[model samples]
Target: MSSRSNISQYQGLLERIVLCFLSTGPACFFLLINGILMFSLRSKPVFRYTCRYILLYNLLVADTAQLIVTQVLFLLAVGRVKITYAVCGTITTMANLTAGISPLTLVIMTLERYVAVCYPLRHASIVNIKNTVVAIIAAWAVSTLNNVTRNLFLIEYPYEKFGKVLMKDYCTNIGWIPDSLCDDYDRAYNAVVFVSASITVISSYTGVVIAAKAASTDKASALKARKTLLLHLVQLFLSLAYTLYYPLLSALAKTVQRIVFVWVQNVIYVLFIVLPRCLTSLIYGLRDQTVRPVLLHYLFCRWKLSVEPATC
Candidate 1:
């Protein structure tokens, strides 16, 4: 290889390292705030019946998972391992689990919102503590099952070519097990999961917008509902787009794609997963009166100042 090529590769590696630093730090901060919010609300009885609390809890959990896995694994890659296929595979699976489950939770949350706003009378009976726990358990269960089933489809294979040559470092000789046996099965399963989750989220939120418009007797209530749905729609778009891109890039290219894919993956981790958790409390705090008061109470306490009368 030429010196120029070596320089370029080194530069790219440096860029990835910088990107990891920029991404992971902010991601961790967001995850920390999310943890605080989740724990704080756990003891609040008023928020127990609301969909916001449930959705917030799920969002925090998924983003926290993403931050921990990505941050630690990337650090490990930098400090210890040389980024082997096995290491990369494990990271990819964990990242996918965090990324994939996020959107699914969004779908469920939007559906929960739809039911609450559309059918206010039945919201209480349907969205109780018992049902919310069940729903959360089911989401985690389904996500785990999906990851296990998909990872099984990928098999590592060794390659040799031109008789008497072991091609360990070359690109062409090193290969996956079989396209027919593994690629199609994995792609089909993942596509189904991604498409189904995206459609479900979008459709449920669309229904939410409609129901909000129809049910709101006042303009202010309708506007508030619209704003919340809009924010969720943006999140849904970001998640779905990345979920589609990651698999597409992996399937199409073999080498040189890592530069683009790795960076893009980091971007999604920041934008879709991390940014939401950091900004969610702020978003709700700035927009909603109820959230603002709760946040203020937590942050700024108005303790009574006792003083003796001044005797001059």
Candidate 2:
């Protein structure tokens, strides 16, 4: 491409930078409020004891991590400076690992809800605190193994004339291999993660719907089932965006076109990852009436005003 073409290609980068800044400001604001809410409710008995609450809390934590990672890396990318390999490797590994695991954790939570609504008799025994903790541990383990294995194979030194540097900045899976092997591996990984989540979601929803049909007379159960389905649907769409963006990245290689791609990717991350987190607190507020009273009580009590709660 000519110099003019290069300039045109990178034109989108400026627009993206503006959008990222706009999105980041709100994301940070949401994170601040969400963090306060999470901490305030941390000790509450309902949040402490419920399996669903634990899952939701984990999701929020993971999303918060995503927000932090993306914002910091994004700033660096925009500045266009050199990044050492060590920092890049670790950040890349952690970001991808955590982000990938979160959706799978959501899948597990969906299954748990399915069992609760579809097979109430087994819900208590199947999804108690102990089992819930074990499930979370298993999820972390699986996600760690996937990232570590993939990174280990991909990250190695290039001898005099033997191998070449496999990846570029920030643990991103970039290589100069003219072969399709790496692509195949990526496709396989995507397939496994996507297929697993899809199957779990389909089965869980099918079970819920079937159970809802049979128990239509129970209005409360039906309503709970519908709410659960809606939440899962939102999560599925967000995750699908996650699964799709990576494959389409290459098509945006023109310098100017990449600007739009970069911003779109960041915006998508906010919508899919960060919004779910902010929505968690909101969802709790809307779905559980008890949360509102407790939250309001925490915010304001009948005690006489003193120096100020900020000091305390």
Candidate 3:
């Protein structure tokens, strides 16, 4: 659908190889850290039963799935490997599902923090093991529903146009669907999801700030909650900004030299798409006191963390 890659075809073979190598280095490293953090979350009973930790585990799982799917798509685009609609649909659907789930999970995490800060006395009862589990399930269920609806619209498209056998170009979500409704649905869904998530985070942050001022409140805990919410807001913003991936490149291609356009596209992928997925693990792994030592121990390859020369 995008004859936009006419400039990309002019890129040198050796140059594409180097670009892939450079991007893969950071992608692999982020995936490694994410794996360690995930293992740390399950290696002990503390994480398994705690409400916030359980929520963290769910969020990490979504982010990891998101990272893997996007990376696979990126590799395909880089190699210019065109495939059948069946393959592209499966991969892009997974990408679309994960992309939506991450923001929703982040919203859940934000609300959990808000409860802890603003309603400390009732936090445990309101956000217990059962409810947190239910929240995570609802996030995934909603995202799956969205994916199914979009695919229905996709199936409704008059495939006689492209013949439905093989995609004419490298796969991206917007490229496969030629319908105006699909584009409009995409814009509307993305706007609603991101905007709602952003508002939720901001409201939670505001609640934490207000609670911090009460004489009955614990200022320390509320302060920490504020900072954490801020980080989540930053992450969400980066995710929302990435919706411009195709249009941004298309505009640049028309104005810049081909070589410069290709290089800028590569850098933008790393900055927006690749980097935000890594932030969730880094932020919570290092920021939370309870998870830090265990995360670091596994991150550096040790089974047990030691402080007394033998054990903590």
- Per-residue lDDT of 128-211 in model 3, one digit per residue for the tens? 888988999999999999888888776766656444578888888876666678778888988999889989999999999999
Cα RMSD, model 1: 8.6
For candidate 1, the TM-score is: 0.67
> Which residues of candidate 1, in runs, are more than 4 Å off?
1-20, 48-51, 76-80, 83-91, 154-190, 201-219, 244-282, 296-312
| Candidates by TM-score, descending order | 3, 2, 1
Any idea how many clashes model 2 has? Answer: 4
- Write model 2 residue lDDT over 39-69, tens digit each, in one string: 5456466777778777767776776676677
On lDDT, the stronger of 1 and 3 is 3
Q: What would the TM-scores of all predictions be?
A: 0.67, 0.76, 0.90
Off by over 4 Å in 2: 1-20, 159-180, 215-217, 246-249, 255-281, 292-312
Clashing pairs in 1: none
lDDT leader:
3
**Per-prediction tally of clashes:** 0, 4, 0
Clash pairs for candidate 3: none
RMSD of each: 8.6, 6.6, 5.0
Predicted candidate 1 versus true structure: per-residue lDDT over 167-246, tens digit per residue: 23311101212345555655675578667766765676666667656645344654565567677666666555544443
| Distance from true location, Cα of 269 in model 3, Å | 0.6
